[model samples]
Target: LLGRFFEARAKGRASQAITRLLELGAKQARLLRQGTQVMVDPLELVPGDTVIILPGEKIPADGVIDAGATSIDQSMLTGESHAVDRGPGDEVYAGTVNQQGRLEVKVTGVGPNTALARIARLVEEAQATKAPVQGLADRISAVFVPVVIVISLGVLATWWIATGDFADSLSNAVAVLIIACPCALGLATPTAIMVGSGRGAELGVLFKGADVFERAKEIDTVVFDKTGTLTRGAMTLTGLDSEADERLFLARVASLEAGSEHPVGKAVALGAEERDIELAPVAGFQAWRGLGATGIVDGVEVAAGRARFMADRGLHIPDRYLEALETFERRGHTAFLAGWGGEVRGTLAVADTMRESAPAAVAELRRIGIETAMITGDSRQTAEVIAAQAGIATVLAEVLPEGKATELARLDAAGRSVAFVGDGINDAPALAAADLGMAVGSGTDVAKEAGDVVLMSGDPMSAVVALRLARATFRTIKENLFWAFAYNTAAIPLAALGFLDPMIAAGAMAISSLSVVTNSLRLRRFH
Candidate 1:
């Protein structure tokens, strides 16, 4: 019992990454109150409070920036080491470092609701959810004790009746009892689970339970969510329609999107800012959810969003512009229409760049005979474009977040076992519904819950490492079970037949348990 307690505690020590995250935040923040800087506890801060952040300081809360521009190191949170430029209205998460420049940010969330806090809570929950693995020895031990007792009594009765020698019968019975070797059976599964899971942790792959390792061997189809899974979730303006005046169109769109917080709008505004284009002051600013942003720019009403937003507002597109838009869409770019003064000014295309490691990761899975598929909420053209770059052959496009699970069900009915990989709250249902769900460690709390395994590195290649490691772990478990059962099965009867003495039986039982432990320890050598 003491040995088992130590083993469990050792396994738990591998999951201290979240505890390290909690230590990264600033304990005290510089609060900006009516133009005065005041020192206060970060916990005392609330939403809408203007907090001043400085260079080499940890952000105290999640909020949209209000002033100053700085490059923030968010690798601790997103697993991407690049410093992202943050300015007014850009979201900065808690626990990230402000590398240079000072900024005043309006707090939107603090404490438990902050992204850093949520990740820590999710990680702790994932660690606690692992269920113990049962081994072949444990199953036999449940009913083997009574059977061993009966066999011993039968041996004693036969020896007494045949020769009437009490010493001989009792000695033979004692041999039978010592040769049972239940200890070998008991240690087989747990020792392997301890070593294998610990090894996985070392590689940044966390198995939620010992059972999850067994399921990975059966995965045939690997489904990936697009945004953030294959491509960087951050969308940026890639190109502007050729017909539009670069300066005039950008100025109109950026001014209209000034007050909008949507990713598309932010991309346009950010693009304009990057080019040093000064935005005009706009009136009648409005944001259409899932559509576009509209406002008056330079005394002319301007709108920028998807083509549907323009159609809904009675704006018409020329055939030439529509053809060019399709060309942009084919290259995996999401195009938005920017029109003003009742005429279609031009189309702007924004695209999420594919992760640099995505292609190699897909190729590795394919080499192992596992097929790769991509599912996304983006249009069919955009989805295919992203999939092509990643070397994924099958694409499920325009599928809503809720419908991803439905697609998984369709694959299940076809006798294909699927593994879903994602990094969002919306992917929770599909992640839970798949045969094996892998969550990016940097994702939301709900995503981690639905995942059977958490890839701590948040890299797609880690998913491959996870599956291969699981199969290897399962193979190790089988070997341990085989050696344990084979040893006891052949040795028990030899002792009963007087081929082995009581002392020899005792030594053999101890050897059998030692062999099982020694074999399970081999999992430590796994790469």
Candidate 2:
């Protein structure tokens, strides 16, 4: 507001003296420090602690719903609209308003574990860590401020001594100072980062800070997990090339495996449903967990499982069917052989297929110069098959959760900054170890919390969105640095020669600072 008044006065839109006095009053109000009435140290809140939140009171810590529900307004921190309904086990963050309902929350996280504290830490880290390229602006500003101040004084003194006109010298100094305010310099980098992060949030991507964001721009390689991350994590029937009523055999298998929890059982059941086949009732259902299931379906002993299960049951599967099963498995598919009594009837081929967006996303990444890779605990065939379909350039198969971090470290040692994208417990270590760890929104809180970047949508396309945001942010930083340095460089010399005025100096400072802030907000449009 003061900046506006000064700006108005400068342009003769408003009278100068009155506006200046009002501005000074506003400044006084801002700078006047008040003593605290009481010295009560704040309490550190923890998760699962029963917390009583009162009207107009700030939440002391992060907690979950333990008993009572509450209508919380978290607009301040998360920019959410309306009061949020929080019940038992739901996470409520600190600094959120309890607009309605009395809350009795079980504190789950206390002190530094609180979301507010985490945000604070992230903000602190953001402020502390400087991107290698962003430091240039700060270096210039450090030298610029003092030099400008000294030059203004020298200019005023020189003019007064030469012309014996104190008032004219003062006017010249005011002009120099006003024109030279370092507003642009101060506005540059931070504004770009703010804009970048804000834009990312709109696209369902949240960057922890500027440094994390900058690393995204430097990544030349990316690694992916196969199941859940690439495929649907659930198998479905692809094609059925068989004889002797395939649907009838599928329905029988579905009934036999209905009580089983194996992926094959579930796949068979789902296939029957998709084909609208009436299920056969099975008596004496028994499961073999990792193997298969057996039951008396339609008064005949039926079995569906691997070839081993069929062979053990004295069933004879034709060589043609066996070859087909082998071919499917080689291409990363799980095939179940179904038979009745002692003869193989049909084959149910199931596999976790790739998402429609995966291929396009991989292509886009390659177009942008990022090399794509996949890491998975799946069999070598499965991993290679998925990688080939997604157009990934590299593949790591049969990688257990413990081995992911080691692979990321190897990539780092090879001069590549690794970004591990995953959404499961297996991803936690890799997320932590990678230069940039990104979690899909569907992942566990621990994984999301561990990641430097989290995509609100689990879409593989979100990776592309994140990368775009990183590039934009990096560009904005460069723009900001340029403007900031330019402001300081131009202002100092004028101020040193009695060519700047005090009021002008103040106005210039206000403008420069405000410009930086405005520039920072530009990232909001990125979404």
Candidate 3:
């Protein structure tokens, strides 16, 4: 009964941690039916149903906004402290709180299909899985039981032959068996893995299996994908130069790009709108495949695209504008030259911004003695610029999607245990090939499936935190194992020598298991 009580307590502690995450979902949902709001259970929500979420209310299902807009606090799911703006056609997940404004969301997923449910399932699976060290413990326990039985038999025979007393010999043999039950050995690695993995979930890190804790602690070098991992994936206007009227030049360029669907063109158009500049109507708009786009704006021919595109259109770029283009390109920005009536008038520099936590994340890794490197398909100049901004020393430039795994192999050949951090479909191979793979939460599903650890926060600093947590968890596992082995090695002989009563032996065995469990519970206090 005492043994069962300790086992139940250890299991209950792990279950409670998982329950906290599962309880984040809102119990009820407000649905819109024929223009009327109806209260319904979250589980009753189905696809195609429009749900109404007001301020200070939790979103009850994963869906797209059908009407209205609001700022949503996604800290519960993504660990981002700030509220993100959600408008028409924006995706919202269950468990996120609506900050302000009314939103009508078209429910796309609910119940087990929701993102929150998937996260809880992953945590449960990780806790249920066993670590590699547990297999060793199992083997030892298997051998230990029989060896202890033999010792107990020997004690019984020696006592009975020396004193001609069977009852006393039997009592000593039973005491030896009771004390050397190997309960502590059985509880050591698994309890630590359960508590450690549960703690990881609370920190926005999800370990795919118990074995990930072992692999993560062995990482000495961390390789990062440049785009969408260390840097924001979206392009933004960073620098603009014009020899003519700045607003007029921007209006003409933005007018020409307003018809395009390319990322750079959208950034240029958005920049003009943010400044409240009015764009003239464009006519005869033509886009060249690899070059820039040109159109007639307000009776003048305006073009916005690459330098080659400007030169192809017989436009002359002044020395000052050319120098500005070089300055922007050298700093990893993609420069667009805008020309009107055969003369280049302005230059636009667009680039992906680095994450706020990237520099500090790299510094933290270095401070902990882990080397950091960056790999990307970008040009050497562009890759180097971003690497320097993130404080990473080694840069692998112009690496194709297929070649990323090869670069990881090269690192492995150099005796480095590498962990790859990536957030795109192209990174799936590299993620799987590394010693440990960390996938950003905002990344593609394929990348997350390949990763051993998922960074739900999507912050570079979370990767550092994941590594620290893994190391701490593994350390706890080792400590538990050591104590279990030491306790058994010291206590078995005392029982065999008749120095311990059977009742005392049983109590000691139960305490040994409880101690291992209590040691693992300390991980719940980890930051």
Give lDDT: candidate 3, residue 411: 98
Q: For model 2, how does the per-residue alpha-carbon lDDT over 1-527 read when each residue is reduced to its tens digit?
A: 44444323222311221222222211100011142222222353333346566555555556665656767766444433446677777777655666666666565655556554544344434444556665776676678668767777887899899999998888877676566655565446555664565455445566776688678988888787766666766777775646877777777888887777655577778888988988877798876533566889989998877777789889999987887777786877766688886988877677886877889989988899888899976556656877889988698876656788899999999999778888634477898999898876431242236688876456688888888878877876776666666666676566655545677767676767666555555655664
Superposed on all Cα atoms, model 3 deviates from the true structure by an RMSD in Å of 4.8
Q: Which model, 1 or 3, shows the larger TM-score?
A: 3
Report the error of model 1 at residue 353, Å: 2.1
Q: TM-scores, in order shown?
A: 0.74, 0.60, 0.84
Candidate 1 lDDT over 321-359, as tens digits, reads: 677678889888987678876667787888887888899
User: Between which residue pairs do clashes occur in model 1?
Assistant: none
lDDT at 254 for candidate 2? 83
How much does candidate 2 score in TM-score? 0.60
How far residue 396's Cα lies from its native spot in candidate 3, in Å, is 1.9
Q: Rank the candidates by TM-score, best first.
A: 3, 1, 2
Candidate 2: residue 103 Cα off by (Å): 25
Which model scores highest in TM-score?
3
